[model samples]
Target: MSDSTVEDFLKSYNPEVRQLVLKTRAVVLAVIPDAIEQVDSPSKIIAYGFGLKYADLICAIAPYKSYVNLIFSQAAQLPDPRGLLTGTGKRARHVKIKTATDIESPGVRSLLEAAVASMTH
Candidate 1:
């Protein structure tokens, strides 16, 4: 349990989903270089944020059976000029990533930047 890593969690998913998960992780990390990663195997989520605890969760990359979800915790507060985010929750919102290309979308990058800025400020 103590040795569990993000790689281990990602391995449980199918190949296509796994690839999307890896790409999504890369995008998030690239945007927030100092973020702390937390792997919650039971929930099948890999969360990236700014602090040592889950409370600081900025975003999470979750792989489903068909697609991957990029969940932004402070999404409601972030600007979504392109209307990319989808969720009716009080705070959380997400963008579905069907391929590696989706992770590199300008809208996704903008959302990622806003999410990180929300946490830092």
Candidate 2:
């Protein structure tokens, strides 16, 4: 979808949550410029493909009441250092972001970069 579509989605939330979603979306798009990304309707969750060809490296941003959840669809397969991710069942794991600083962590950044790299391959 268009950039405005993404922006509108982010703006629908409260200012605090809106800013967090906007920043996270920027970082993800910066890493995966050619991502097959979309702003899903109904829930308005933001999702991006690591590459046009990859299936396992999609990242979706889901906001909770007090925090944002970075849902890594392929987290179960990625190298889990720092033990920052959690999930039940199988093949789904996520790292919760309570504040902007959470995104500043090296482990978190690495996870996003690794996802993009792995998908590009």
Question: Where does candidate 1 clash, by residue pair?
Answer: none
Q: Which numbered prediction scores highest in TM-score against the true structure?
A: 1
Please estimate how well model 2 matches the true structure, expressed as its whole-model Cα lDDT.
0.74
Model 2, 83-106: lDDT tens per residue?
Answer: 988887377688888788887678
The collision pairs in model 2 are: none
CA-lDDT, candidates in order: 0.86, 0.74
TM-score of 1: 0.92
Q: What is the TM-score of each candidate against the true structure?
A: 0.92, 0.83
Off by more than 4 A, model 2: 50-57
Whole-model alpha-carbon lDDT for candidate 1: 0.86
